[model samples]
Target: MIAIIADDLTGANDTGVQYKKNGYSTTVKIMNDNDVSSSMFKTSDVVVINTDTRPLSKKDAYDCVFKLAEKLNSVNNLEYIYKKVDSLMRGNPAPELEAILDSTDAEIAIVASAFPDNGRIVTDGTLLMPDNKHVDITNIFNTETKRKAVNVRLINVREGAESLKQYMEGQMENGADIFVFDTVSNEDLATISDAAMLIGKKKIFCGSAGLAKQLGRKKKAEQKYDGTVFIVVGSRNAATAHQVRMATETFKLPVVLVNSEEIIDGRYEKAVSESVEKAKEYYLNGNKVVIIAIDSLFEEYTVVLRATATENAKSLKVAESLGDIVKRLYEHIKPVTFVATGGDTAFQICNFLGSDGMELVDEIVPGVPIGILREGMADGSSMVTKSGGFGDEDTLVKVINYLMVNRK
Candidate 1:
């Protein structure tokens, strides 16, 4: 089995979905070092552990990763270890990578933080963002420890896997502990993967979903899930709002707009019951999808309502209220598929449903991950999660289509 260590839940699912799309049974454990069980590694071909260390200090992140890596390296069936870093290099990747290298038998680390589809590319050792801004490689490893790294330019990568392997070997001999490859496209990532395969397993791979897609093992199998999908959109991001609007308007799906004020006023039970009734009516009426979203998330009235509550209470009340709606829907209709927009909304829904984590399956779009609830009342139920600000207007439409095609 292959193991992936990630800093966040979305990163874990997005990377794990690469293997799942290749027909591997993959599970993402939102677990800590101590909560980790043997069953996580034994039950799936690929397991992704969400260490959730992005917000942690370098020392804390390093210690967490080192201990986990040390324990995982001893797993008899562990084939490979992939360190999943943020595509935009937002986290303490350098320390986490170093920790893995220190704890495992890996002598060198191959680093590639480019996801071209997401408009992130490493060019001449600098990261190019979607907005065309540039970030230097050195700035990413901003910790006190200055690690030695070399960038395999685009020209070197295009020269073929053998040529790249020879260049990497030369650098390894010259005391470079990390090789960061410059990639402008998916083809470049594939070339890097070939080189890594040729070089052997004494090295650890650290990258985003881009590299994971190329390195993942594909077994070609079929997975079929059935039922209409329930979408809960709690993000105030304009992008998500537009997508939801497009999907509901174009497809003529029923939408229930949550009264944020009612929820905050402690009428969540009434809100949940009313929303469930509407959702159940739509389901019985033969609608393939139902959307539950906050009433006018982009409107000024909603903003004012949010501001009226304390910062912490605002998020807590809204997230819990949305979670309650999802829970009630589950109890009322038993919908096998659910889609959640916004990270807090997703986490709260899982919490309310008694889930420890999710079993990742596939992606509806580039960064939109689809998985199944794990170890809860909603266990084995399909779920799709999207970052509020990620995806285009048609992303929800694509999700709807994907569910229709893959549903049992």
Candidate 2:
């Protein structure tokens, strides 16, 4: 039996569904009560706890995990345990839990988000890579453009920051000019307008459908940006992309609408291959390339692979095969820089490069987790992998902007 606990029903459901699909008889329980007994824990072979709802202080979180581990210890049948804390900033006790784990001989895996306010020690989480069978697009760039400083901005919406980071890094050998600004309300839009005035360049605003609609209503004459590209990328339905495209066109911006499904489709390998061909042409034509991908992971690719593969042996085989493919591809492209998002993607890429497995390095800002692989340190060959994760779409865009401006 596996017990998964979360602060809210949504997080529990998401994590539970994954475990269930992985052939485990899982039970998802909301963590409302403070007291859990060994007898209660003995019923499950594995236990998962969500630490988001509890107070985030190191001592508080440590107490909760310590008690839970004590309860699991009483149940000799417990083989594996996982604890998930949703937010790092909202009083997560990850540091205390790590310290306690170091001292104890507990068989447990802990995963947590390191929101900006949280300290470094508590931010580290286990990295899980996808199976080898899946194909991933690392750094994808288009033709070189004459523009020296490209301004990439995202409206403060859902999951945009992380998505934008992947897309921008994919498009250029080096990261593009990126900026993160809030556009959730009128005040954010005004702030963006003020910033645009200070740094005048070609500004591309990326956002979901809802944010694009809000911007449409504002119609602030001063908010117009030169060479503005509105990228409509989100996990929502196709309707959202269409709506954003329409709104951006109303402003007469050079909008390039991208369908999230098209980019993230299982056929990503093929789509990216074609995109790369186009990029080569653009590069040959002397245009600086800027590529942006948003909201790529709606459904976990791991679940999809597990469902498609006939057996666990086949799943592992496919994952290994994918590693080989990525290894060969990296050798060929030799990109100057690479950026990735999410634990699974980072792990898979690192494995492909035959690097010292995947490790959570640091949090670039709040809600964004960065994973790094040192240059020339992998087993097979040296490959560079720079990736980060944002919990939602809005943050995805923020990361893209941050990278665009800061890319060295």
Candidate 3:
């Protein structure tokens, strides 16, 4: 039985769902005494525990994971453990990694966070994404303002597993706790996975959802949605705004604008009632892709003016309203493909639609992923997600084209 440990609810859901998609009955446990249902253990082949310790201090976080690791270690059927970290390298990975290392016989922890499909790659010990940039390791974890800088070493995968082992041993001698493995593609990830599994001593795996997907690849359902696709655009970024415009003008995709400002005024419920019906009409009238955006012109400008910390809460309300619109339309139309852009908006929609987690099947674009949910919808209903600033002007139209030409 595989066990996945995550820092947040969404991370647990998304990573665990990947295993579920691959035919393992998976459960995302809330990790509370009264909440961990016994039936979940009986039904799931994999049990994912959400520690919910990302926001905690280093000591607290370490203690939380240590306790959980101890509990899992007691389980007779528990196999190797997977420590899930954020894809963007957010949150504290070292403390939790240390807990896993201390609890298990695992001599080394493999830290591979390269999700090439999501356009994030680690090459030569530096994160190579957003234009071949490496993380600023020197200042990242130095919370104490006056602490001396810690030097980190990057070992290339081309150096082979022996070289990696020697380098890790050297790092251990020098007191380095974590190491990042470089990967440029899916093949590279598979190679790394194989090498880690072949380690002489026991090992613990640490990475984002990408590495988990690679390690747990199996024959599962193929998710394809060539039918009506609904595109939900909630990003106020100019890049997304331009993409929305290009998609409608270049592809003639139907557009339905929701008054997001109304949400801030406590009128979101009133707005969704109309948007959902219009979306239904638009889809039924022979439009293959329907673009649901906020009043783009207003969003384009107000988003700039609302750039203060005080206004962020209000901005979230607008995001929530946009999510509600998408949820209503999705349930009403049951569109084959659900495309949601912007992180907050996408999370809200997934929450409403009960997309506890999804199995990643394809990349609509680099860093823009399309996948099938493990539950809460039709088997093949494809769900696509994108960051607010991920793509270019023609990205949206190109996604629709990909869906059209590559039907399963």
How many clashes in each candidate? Answer: 2, 44, 0
| Model 3 TM-score (2 dp) | 0.70
TM-score of candidate 1 relative to the true fold? 0.83
Clashing pairs in 3: none
TM-scores for every candidate against the unseen true structure: 0.83, 0.31, 0.70
Which candidate do you rate higher for lDDT, 2 or 3? 3
Evaluate residue 295 in candidate 1 and report its C-alpha lDDT on the 0 to 100 scale. 81
Q: What lDDT does candidate 2 reach at residue 126? A: 20
State how far residue 158 of model 3 sits from its true place (Å). 2.3
Better of 1 and 2 by TM-score: 1
Can you give the lDDT of residue 109 in candidate 1? 79
Expressed as tens digits, the lDDT of each residue in 1-408 for candidate 3 is: 877888765566556656755667676555554433334467667877777665566678888888778766666666678998766665567678777777766665677776676577665456644534457533442332122223323334556656656656666677554556667777766666766665565667888767777756564544556777888877776668888888888887788888776777788778777778788899889887898877753353322311444565775676677667766776667646878776556656666766555555555555565666555544446777676555667788888887887775
Candidate 2 — what's its lDDT? 0.33
In candidate 1 the C-alpha lDDT for residue 134 amounts to: 71
Measured with C-alpha atoms, the lDDT of residue 279 in candidate 3 is 84
Task: Give the candidates in order of TM-score, highest first.
Answer: 1, 3, 2
State the lDDT of candidate 1 residue by residue for 97-203, as single tens digits: 98998899988778888887676788888986544557676445534345678778999999999999999888888887788889989899999989988986487
